[model samples]
Target: MNYNSPHKGMTLIVKTITRITVGLILLYGIYITLHGHVSPGGGFAGGVIIALSFIHLMLAFGKEEALRRLPKPLVSLFESLGAILFFTIAILGFVGGYFFLDWLNKGEPFKLFSAGSILLSNIAIAIKVSFGLFGIFLVLVLLKFTPKK
Candidate 1:
């Protein structure tokens, strides 16, 4: 297994195209995640897109390459961390005497950096969903179903 070239799974054209578009896809996911509070899409949708980008890497290059980019241990770490972060954020609302309360100062409306903890909450959810979906995909890909003769 040549760790240098993860593009061995698909044809040259697919690999090239994936290499070019994967970044854009991931970036778009981030954009959707960030703009979720005001836009139609939210954290779950963005996270799925983000996970799709990684799956696209696996389809274009190979599982080894995708795993190289997102290892099992890291996935596990992020899974727990994201959950904890989200829980912590919700818990922080206790200062305002409520669960999942909006205590932070919400800036001007329609601005990129506005909405306070909403954006942070969206981010945490995105991280958790992305890692969870990606991990599920990896498991399915790794599953070896025996053929019945």
Candidate 2:
């Protein structure tokens, strides 16, 4: 059998398990990010989870597949977009005469939308973190790691 196939990576068992679990992992990450305001997990945690899912894919299915799903350019674009979004949100606070102010209406407490601008900030942070981490991972993987000559 040809071992150099782009689809080739880990063994069949690992591939099967990864295929099954990756979606669930991604969903769980989204859940943690969206419900962070009400729960303990927040943007950073959720973003790490999300990046791990992609990293898991890369490990199990090889970099080709993972990069195909989330190309490097798209990753950079998203990271920049996240920063822009966070900055824009902060700038909007200028209307309240301060930076990073909670300018939006705070909904009923303990509810999903209760955090107002915080929720948006969390989303922005998640976007930035997830993509930034994944991008860094890609760079490291591409780097030639050589031991002493």
Candidate 3:
């Protein structure tokens, strides 16, 4: 059977499997990020997982397909936005007379919305880490494969 698609990479089985599992991977990453405070995994861990999903796609479907899903410009944009979001939230903490302070009301312990600023921070960190890691992976991959002058 012809495994080749418009974009080139692994075989049909690999692609099929990747297609089935990538979304689950992404969702798991998100779950980790959201419940970070209540659980062990946090933004950094979740972000790595998220980035891995995209990397998996690249490995299974090739660079063209991966780039099509997350274009370079969008990656750059997300990276910037994540940083901006993190910075903005940090700055907002000044309202409480400190940097990175938990200005928002701390709800009941162990609840989803219990940690206000922390949740936001985790989200920002996740966004930054996910796109940042993906960007780094892209750079390393492209750099290594590029022809020497």
lDDT by candidate, in order shown? 0.89, 0.89, 0.89
Ranking by TM-score: 1, 3, 2
Task: Give the clashing residue pairs of candidate 1, or none.
Answer: none
- Kindly report which residue stretches of model 3 are placed more than 4 angstroms away from their true locations once superposed: 1-7, 144-149
Measured against the true structure, the TM-scores of the candidates, in listed sequence, are: 0.92, 0.90, 0.90
lDDT of 1 at 34: 96
Q: Candidate 1: worst 10 consecutive residues by lDDT?
A: 1-10
| Residue range 63-112, candidate 2, lDDT tens digits | 77777779999999999999999999999999999998887899998888
Question: By the TM-score metric, which is better: model 1 or model 3?
Answer: 1
Best by lDDT: 3
Q: Write the per-residue lDDT of candidate 3 for residues 1-149, one digit (tens) a residue.
A: 23467448988889889989999999999999999999899999999999999999999988877887799889989999999999999999899998888879989989998788888888999999999999998888777565789
Off by over 4 Å in 1: 1-7
Residue runs of model 2 more than 4 Å from their true location after superposition: 1-7, 146-148
